[model samples]
Target: MKFICCGNKGSMPVNDNGIPMDTKKETEAGEPKYGLGVRHWQTFLYFFALTVAYAQRVNLSVAVVAMTDAAAANINFPEYDWPEKTKSLLLSSFFWGYVITQVPSGQLARKFGGKITLLTGLSICSVLNILTPLFADWGGWQLVCALRVVEGLCQGVVFPSIHTLISTWVPPNERPVLGTCAYTGNQFGTIVMLATSGLLASSSAGWPSIFYISGGVGCVWSVFFFIWGASSPAEYKRISPEERKMIELAQASESTSEHPKEKLHTPWLSFFTSPAFLALIIAHSANNWGFWTLLTEIPSYMKNVLGKDIKSNALLSALPYFAMFCMSFVFSAIATLLNKRNCISTVVSRKLFNSLGLWVPMCALIGLAYVDADQSNLAVILLTVTVGFNGACYLGFQINHIDLSPNFAGILMGITNCVGNIMSIIAPLLVGFIVTNEQDVEQWRIVFFIAAAIYLVGNGLFIIFGRASVQPWNDPPAKHRRNSTPQVESQH
Candidate 1:
């Protein structure tokens, strides 16, 4: 309960009862120490948990590529008539469960601690992943689809909970880096899955072992996370006095209070009425449609259109995510740099990044539409850049969760993620319709064109309307701020 203030001006140590000690002359001491601490360790644990969730979630894409081949061997299907549709269904079924559970999972994160909700979700997902290959032949494709759906549902809470954790634990100045670091898990997970799955699948052991490996990793990470992570800074035992003061100061500046113990009444109407929130949802939804479609479909595309084998296909499919992982850090740093320099407003920085991110992919998709499958190397490069640009959108939307409402970041992220997940349903169905004949280059062009157009429209809306300021509903009036104690500390 004690507080300490440190700065270039000085240091003032305050007692637990809020009494200032007579160290007035010593107040002007030196610079504040800022680096990794117990809270940072907590953040690291949450980030690790998130990485594990993403690793398990995307492992299926790699597994499906191998699974189809294994299943084909068992059924004695011809190479040309392989069960591609069934494979696509398995990849897409996870999205169905993921999209449906976002809101409820977020609610759970808000109601219970994020630590408990996320840990429980990962536990369920790990068990289901282990059970997947076991049920593959016994219950057949239907059982596999059911298990995937279950995995998706459990994994759906991962992002929202992580968002909440970052909002709670990281200071404003550090959020961009933290957010980017947290999101890098998805790209890293994709890289690990794509890189390893094929090598494992190519062995005599076959495809099911890929699931087992990824499942085991998740289970192990879950144990570490449960041990190391606390729900919030207040619950942490080892947070330094200086770091705690920094968090308190930043929260006060942002005007966010500690989350109440009681369940928040749903402000559905208020959320629905916020045009800026709606714009963000639409923009992110469109981005997700384009991103997930490419992610889920790329392996099949590589094999069918480029005629690549499992090893090469896995390598090619992973290239985009690796590029994305690199780009996310660059783009997030650019936004933060812009904010610090006063080169642009936060709203403008977000809009600029969002527009560029969408437009780059649009051009790439268009180029992809015109390129022949014979130009396989060029096609892969374009696909890599196209998906890499997808990470840029995070600079806009991901940071906006904290920008708009640090207090309600968990709920806000849940809402955005829930709405955006609608695209998960749309993307697979759209691809199914457009790429009815996967071998036809022209047919696939239509899918790319549609994705490009959607991104364009969404970015345009964000440019025109998105605002980075906190929601009016959550902000106190100027008079209220004036009336409050000058030394009041915000708790978040």
Candidate 2:
């Protein structure tokens, strides 16, 4: 049986005897090698996962306006009292469960392989989405909220599992491009949901059809993913010996240590003790607060503040994410070029992109706050640019997981995302409180100010504390031993 190795550099292959040999030597010795062979297909698999997950997740956002109107139309008759507040709660309820599961979900991924964990999560989410339409008779608002929570809990593992797979499968050089591709799914999914849901919801089938459509798509995708995706390169049958050798060589050149058999005994005590980790956590939390606040509430904002019709609002809301999809690849390519050229340290490069990304959004938020609702088109343009700029930050924060510790990247991502998702819970509630029946400009202004401040602070922490150095714990004992050895005398 072949065992996998992890190290500061990346992943490596070891012989059955546990001796380290160059990947080239192994290939020469007729041992199998894995490279980028059929590896691009894995990217497609990940893309599919993201596409389906985001489509399902964003369906609620697309359905919210229609559902609210439906509830209001039936409110006068008798059985239900569906206030706007209840509608907002139903829309936001998913994040509550999503936030609670991030950490545990990551741990579970570590316990299981990414393939199993991801398939399970997607399966559960699909089932819940299908059941969502069924719950309409049980007071649609309450039923929707309950199902949203269940769906969120199941879906919470998606990001962490994706991170784990990337760390295990993708070469460090390829990570920037792959990361961008994975995130672009968010943009694409949002676009598809917004574009299609409006038409779907407008029919007599109403908002539930949006859920059914998205759920059906997700279930279909999940079946294909389970059939196709491998847990790691070792498990992939299509990878060629030459490709495998190249992958092992690239991974081995970076570090000597092998992958840990157990999960990086997350130094929880040390994590708390280290200011660097704390700062990373805090920065990500703040960053997510701004991100989620905008994502979850943008459709509602367009509808209520800009006075747009549902179809128009959906189109406008999707514009920013569409721009983001285009920009993410561009920005990631630039970052990777800089990395290849050694033009700047990894930390510096990541921070530079992150700073620019956050600053643009900060300025855009200020502009958004000041814009008159009458100038809805102008507001939409500025907001689109703001969210588009937000995509640049992924080069820093998203890829930093692998940069820091290839072995524990998944776990660290879990920790960061779990903490970050608290913002998701907070964002919708904050928006609900601020943009009530009065539609107070002052309240919305307060929300924007808070979001801007969070982004600024998060960026500051990243600049001050984030480092791209592979964590010391992930380094091999061999390298340290070799470095520590004293020079020997030449007796001759």
Candidate 3:
């Protein structure tokens, strides 16, 4: 196979004998040009979908703050008298539904198609988001909690669908960068949602406007998503034959058929018993413990511990996510470079990136605990850098699912995400008990220490046990031997 000239993070012209070119100097140049690759378009649109998904998911946190404000009385909005416990319930309600749908969504994505599964999820969420304010006012916090749970049910299929589609479409060489493009939307979306929710709520349109805005954008994006989204390269209408052949080469599948073979069975027992999969669950759960702890409490900490005003707190709290989003692309490129150059195996690269993602944040948590109110600037920077490093997770366990089981990527994502969502739930409840007085800095230190410890243990187990090679059960038809998944390019 011959290679063509490439751009940053871009695919090179490919023939049967080779994969995409090295991305070392390429990523430095920027997004690689893929003129007729619908794969690139799909990745970009998936990023937008996830951004809208998170915006709908998190707009409530900021909106709820303004929801209880009498300052909005001049507008049509009414202040609600919600107890702390009720407010907590409202905030935590989404995960109740989120945790339940993972396995089912994974199965559905396989049985049906990712494009349909994702669109269905997003459609349900956007409608719920639009109706949230009206329901919250009419039925009160109870209704709001119920609605959030429903929204979670709708949104739960998102990542699994994305994973399934990626397994079908993304070339192995560009998977890290393209996958990061989609997944990093989590950080980028949260940052935008938190930053803008208040501004929308404070406007004459009031708290209701944030919901309206998020829901409206979601609805619009859904239309585009349904039209442009394809289950596989074979299904994509506009992709050039050159790009389609590249996709075929990337998968190295014996069949060049347009449609993926339908496989109805999920290897649930095999998955549960796998040490490698279990290791991922541990790592994913631990990452969520730290991430969710910071996500749920950062604004509160900014308000209570550091005594920052609302605007300052919002922007400062958002800084970490902003840093995280920007850092995602850089490390994704590095992971691709490392693997492309044969410097390390894919498994080693996952561990290395996962270590950087987990351990740096762990250390940052420890450092943050020592930074008092007098050192608030350092505290903010610590938090920013911590989350920035967290973005390396895209190159870690996040994409490891595809490596472990391209045929079952959706299932793995769902199962691992289930574990993480449960951890996300538990972390908040654990933190609630730890920080009896939110104003107490010492108590918060204990919380940070607990998160760091979780990271320490989880990363340790993963390094010891995680497997990046495809599992034996993934493709019954293929004759690949155990632990013999061929990589895109050999380092040697």
Judging by TM-score against the true structure, name the best candidate.
Answer: 3
lDDT of each: 0.74, 0.73, 0.80
Per-residue alpha-carbon lDDT of candidate 1 for residues 1-492, written as tens digits (9 for 90 to 100): 011221233445544433332221223356354534555466566656766776777777777766666542222321222365676677778878887778777677767778887888898898788787788766778888888888888888887887777877777767766667777777888887887777777776567777888888888988887766767777755555666767767766776434453223456677778888888888888888888888888887898899888888888888998998899878877766666567887788788888877889999999998989899999999999898887887777777877887766777788788778778767876787667788999998998999899988988888887988878655432222434565542322
- Distance (Å) between predicted and true CA of 57, model 1? 1.8
In model 2, where is the ten-residue run with the lowest total lDDT?
Answer: 1-10
Candidate 2: where is the Cα deviation over 4 Å? 1-36, 71-81, 253-259, 475-492
Misplaced by over 4 Å in model 1 are 1-33, 71-82, 256-265, 475-492
Clashing pairs in 3: 8-26, 10-32, 342-491
TM-scores of the candidates in the order shown: 0.86, 0.85, 0.87
Clashing pairs in 2: 5-259, 6-258, 6-259, 33-244, 34-243, 34-244, 35-243, 35-244
lDDT of 3 by residue, 1-492 (tens): 111223444455432323232222323448344433467678888899899998887777667666775463224678899754555577778888998898899888978889999999998899899999789878999899999999989888998999989888887666777888889879878998878766676677877888898999999998998777788878865566667877877686523333344632456788899899999999999998898888877877887788775567677878899999988878877776666568898788889999999999999999998988778899899999888999988888888898788878998999999989998777777776778777899999998999999999999999999988878766544323456536611211
Clashing pairs for model 1 are 9-28, 10-27, 10-28, 10-29, 11-27
**Residue 279 of model 1, lDDT score:** 89
Name the runs in model 3 displaced over 4 angstroms: 1-36, 69-76, 254-261, 477-492
Report residue 365 deviation for candidate 3 (angstroms).
0.7
- Arrange candidates by TM-score, descending: 3, 1, 2
